[model samples]
Target: MYKIYNTILDFSDYLKYDFLSLSDKPVTQTPTSISIQFHQKPESNFVWIDSRDYPGLFASGYSNDPTELWKCLNDAILSYFGVPRYEAKKRGLPYSLPLPNGQAIVQQDAQKYAGA
Candidate 1:
């Protein structure tokens, strides 16, 4: 379980860093509004705690089985970067501010987790 928890911590840290960077973007189009966009379908990629229509990846029986560590890892990745439950259910892509360096930070993190 230590590996699982470590993975979660690392993923959470990456997300927090990425989101904070995203929040720092300068607003342009709408002075009082903030807009974010994503390249993938959030629902198909990740699961949020509040999601209803699609049960979370972990909610599936496979995720809970100790033998299915890969499933847990996949679920964690989805939960970390996928769209929030309310929005994902509406077919919304996950929203994050684009990083100034144009780096795909989330994808990198996912890869790191997978490779580990």
Candidate 2:
């Protein structure tokens, strides 16, 4: 599972990519990872993950301990890609490959939300 904490994704093409891709369906990939960067409000515990390539798409975390905010970003992306919240939480996001012909694997991993 990949954590989208302080890394900024340069691939604006997947600006719609969701941290929602953190999953446990089969645990197999090409061993690739994306770097993440984020922004935090100066006065509060508000944090956000925005992308230059993914304009209008962003993920934020605001909980006191601050681990579930990224989940919101995943929700936004799944919804953008037409996945409902209930279903996503239940079975996790679907697996897919990337790029112009690829899809972001944003899954709401239970462990991630559990703050593992």
List runs of model 1 lying over 4 Å from the truth. Answer: 22-116
Predicted model with the maximum lDDT: 2
lDDT of 1: 0.34
lDDT of 1 by residue, 43-102 (tens): 453322222323342222221232233333334334544533222222222222233237
Q: How close is every model to the real structure, measured as TM-score?
A: 0.19, 0.41
Report lDDT (Cα) of residue 65, candidate 1.
33
- What C-alpha lDDT do the candidate models reach, one value each? 0.34, 0.45
Q: Please report the TM-score between candidate 2 and the true structure.
A: 0.41
Model 1 CA lDDT for position 3:
88
* True-vs-predicted CA distance for residue 107, candidate 1, Å: 25
